[model samples]
Target: MTSKVHLPYFDHLLELLKDQNQTAIAAFGRHVHWGYWEDPSSADGSIPDFANAAEQLSRRVCDAAKITDGLKILDCGCGFGGTIASLNERFSNLEMVGVNIDERQLERARSQVHPLNQNSISFVCADACNLPFEDNSFDVVLAVECIFHFPSRETFFKEARRVLKPGGYLAICDFVPLKFSLPFTHLIGKFLTTSVHNTYGTIKSNFSLSTYRQLAQKTGFITRIEEDITRNTLPTYPLVRKLFRENGAAETEKITAGAELVSKLGITRYLILSFEAIDP
Candidate 1:
């Protein structure tokens, strides 16, 4: 578990997210991960219900993690703590802790998430590579669209395993390349909604799904469920494309479009992977 993120892009991202940007925040209604569109028909619409779509995506991820009423969960790279907030409403008497390296996001998330949800809901400013909690502390560790932003996805995996109880789950939706190639691997990052359009941003990992599954296997976890929900989430790219253009990200707009085309051509694999940490 060595860090892969360094320098300008990660630094640039910190500054960009220090304060709430109206354009970016609008896409999430506070939850800013790439949304899941439950309605396949909405995938190609000129105007998709992004708020609804975003919530659906979170719920989908939540469902995969099997979030229960009383379980303790950690949302790694939890931005604005929106997922926790949503979960709080549905799952009562639960302890929800969201950890992120960004202070601004923590500040906003604290504002949005009430301290009392029949159980405490809190935010912590901590790195994903090294969590601030004791080992085996949580029932589940969730990363929705944010694992790729980690300094090392593998490190986060190891850390999540340490923090999670033996049967606890790690649920995530991450970008995976169809096949690893130097050219396509480099190009994939540009199309993502994670990075701000033209700025030098964090380098994203484009590991294939199999590579990740193998990593999970090596990490002492079993892949309980791994579904390619790519088609279900296709509405994200077009909306992101238009959002970039409207927000004056000319370069990112093209990249977003390019990413969309390849996705349609069946190259990009956005997966919902849930693994349960098991002791050997």
Candidate 2:
């Protein structure tokens, strides 16, 4: 039997198109770092039992989305269905579903989310840029911390619009650059890590908040909120480092150094955006 080999960045995505379910499950199983998915309460040694930041972000995004009961919600780039599980727990009335391009992650999501426990939840492997759902299928479409991987922001916005019902909403949480110069720390980190492919790699991505809002508006969605969560990420960097140290990951040392460098460089950080679908 011939063993499978990973393709290049974009080609890997195309292969995922063959069966989104399998792709998600396989990719997550092989690549995801579960420790990084820490609960916010457990984030810092001082912030005891606080709601997880990611969960809080998910909640805030949902709030920003203004979803109502019986609303069809699509979680684009829903990694291992974390957001889906979070939102479902908070709002049982919502009809929540998630889509990703990795099959391995989808498998974990299915296994973790019991069928009888929350029938409203569903996970499938699908591309974020080109969603497979029919037009106007959902009341809300959310892409949390995942849209950065999208090859084309415009296509992603268009697809989100296509799947969302009139008057529906869209929310995205991702990293954005603060200034023009490429931070040296990142370049150094990349050189240290096993290329961008083997680890959390940056791509031909843009970071300006203005650019994001402009893309959304140009793609036909009404951009609502552009929030700065940089402080949140910076403060919690230590916590993530602690978690990594506890887990004994070799990358812990590098991440700690990188965090310090990031702070010193004065780079603007990650953020979450909210938008609404409006037809002219």
Candidate 3:
């Protein structure tokens, strides 16, 4: 098991699930990331609403990957197999593999998500930066709101490119820092290192949009879609913070509040990016 990754948030979530916390299970049983709302104001801030919004976010990323019937897809950093389950329910005759570094998460994913709609679903315990697969193995690769926890974006890009078939899409959603706000965000991150570590565990949100393009060019991929949906995802913070507070994760709630502040101020933008694998 590749247990090198440290995610205190997941640990907390797992404990909550063990205790049969219905609200926690409803909000994060499947998806462990932020939610997305088409109309930010329409967000009801309820558990069911947040779960639906989270599903929408997964669909948005899958659409960006151009997934279709009978395609083989690899979802890296898959948390509890939420995206995979969504794909299974929507598409047919698809081969989907959900990979996560944490065995605990993978176990939950395997136990919860089953193949449906003529789709095949499997979970693998592996690091995103070091994929355990052959070259040209998948038609589409996805990383949904979990790239920040990766050891190295460049390495993960290379790995994704290696495993993807020719012209395959690599779609990911990440928290990208605005170019001008890099220094300020870095300074703040340094100051809140302990708090952030205790909450999210090993997040690297300092990467900029321009750097993503450059990385794609260097990793034999072409930028296909670069959309900033920060506003669409803003509704997630309040609900998540409320849940964290109710769950007695005060530090986590505080850290999440800080993230919400930066995102609202446009210092940190949530971006959905898709790149096509090209000939090397």
Candidate topping TM-score = 3
> Which wins on lDDT, candidate 1 or candidate 3?
3
Tens digit per residue, CA lDDT, model 1, 161-197 = 9999998899998867776453665655445545533
**lDDT of each prediction vs. the true structure?**
0.76, 0.62, 0.93
What TM-score goes with each of the models?
0.85, 0.74, 0.98
lDDT over C-alpha atoms for residue 260 of model 1:
71
Ranking by lDDT: 3, 1, 2
| Model 1 TM-score relative to the real fold | 0.85
| Candidate 3 all-Cα RMSD | 1.1
The parts of candidate 3 lying over 4 Å away from their true place are none
Runs in model 2 deviating more than 4 A are 1-43, 46-51, 115-119, 182-194, 201-205, 245-248, 252-260, 263-265
State the number of backbone clashes in model 3.
0
Cα miss at 269, model 3 (Å)?
0.5
Better of 2 and 3 by TM-score: 3
Ten-residue stretch with the least lDDT total in model 2 = 1-10
lDDT of 2 by residue, 36-131 (tens): 223334354333222344456667667778866667899887766767776666665677788877765577678766433333878877778878
lDDT per residue for candidate 3 within 102-145, as digits (tens), equals 99888889999999888988898889999999999999999999
How well does candidate 1 score on lDDT at residue 200? Answer: 31
